[model samples]
Target: MKGILCTLLLLLWMITGCSNNSASNMENNKKLAEAVKQETEMPLEMPTDFNFMVSFGYGDVTKNVIDTYEGTVTKDLIIKGSATAEILFTADELRDIYDKMKTIDIMGPKELSKKGNCFQTPSNEDLWKVTVGGETKTFSWTDQKCGITEDANQLRELRNYIQHMVEGLEAYKTLPEAEGGYD
Candidate 1:
């Protein structure tokens, strides 16, 4: 009878351990799912009339702000337009492009341009090369050890940056309209 009880107890313990592990795994999976959903839901907004330059290189990431300096070309008058926030990136981010050029082999030379606005390349490889206005910038992987590794943190940062630019552009677009003119 003692032997039977001991065996039964051991079996119960093993079952409990397995169940706990499964529960932990399920929790982790749920968290991951939520994170992914949030990321996907993040919006990428761009201005109606602006450009952004981003660079993801080994040195520094650079984002050049570019905008059309519109001027009213009347019969004999030229009025300078206002400045707007184009796009922003760092130089280091641009350099990363060369480091992982191999992964971008599938990309074509067709520039990702938008009508009357800016351009943003689709996420490819581990790099993000985007252009706004007439300027261009790059975004490369920071963690070399995780190169090619689709880490959630890296993705989140990239997404945040893009989203930020979108918001800036959106705000910029409204500025001129609100003033009823760009002077």
Candidate 2:
């Protein structure tokens, strides 16, 4: 009886320890990161035309996909839009983002792959929209290493590069420029 009880406790401890990286924890982290982003974004009057603007975020998920860092970059600025305001970024950082953007094969596969293993989580369904001549083009991609589809290998190199670019940009979060209330 004593040995059985000890083995049960050991199994419970192992399960608890592994839960730190469990899928539930991943979802929680994404939710918390999105909440923080919403609280800190800055406010700016958008151009009158939705016909010509820029935006970027995760693609279609059954649930809203949350990224640790996601936003849009224009010629002179990076704007993280939220209900409250926009968190502003500098020209240098935005410039780097744009440069990296140039290298990414944004033209993703014609269709996304189905989910991978039961334990597998798909990579960020990255999407970006840029407007040129009043027309907006949205590009999207995701990595599902389940081997169920050929796209798991296609654009693999660019996907890796883009993942690193987003993670690196986290360190460069600059000013949170809010709208002026000058009387």
Q: Can you give the TM-score per candidate against the true fold? A: 0.28, 0.30
Query: Which has the greatest TM-score?
Result: 2
Candidate 1: RMSD over Cα atoms? 17.2
Scanning candidate 2 in windows of ten residues, the lowest lDDT window is 45-54
Question: After best superposition, candidate 1 residue 161: deviation in angstroms?
Answer: 18
Clashes of each: 33, 7
Give one digit per residue, the lDDT tens place, for model 1 in 1-183.
Answer: 999999999999999999999999999999997776554331233323332223322222222222222211111111333334443333443233222222332122323321333322322222454443333445444433332344424443554554454444444444333223212
Roughly what TM-score does model 1 have, to 2 decimal places? 0.28
Q: Show model 2 residue runs off by greater than 4 Å.
A: 1-85, 105-123, 132-135, 144-183
Global lDDT for candidate 1? 0.39
Q: Any residue pairs clashing in model 2, and if so which?
A: 41-85, 41-86, 42-85, 42-86, 42-87, 43-85, 43-86
Worst 10-residue lDDT window for candidate 1 reads: 69-78
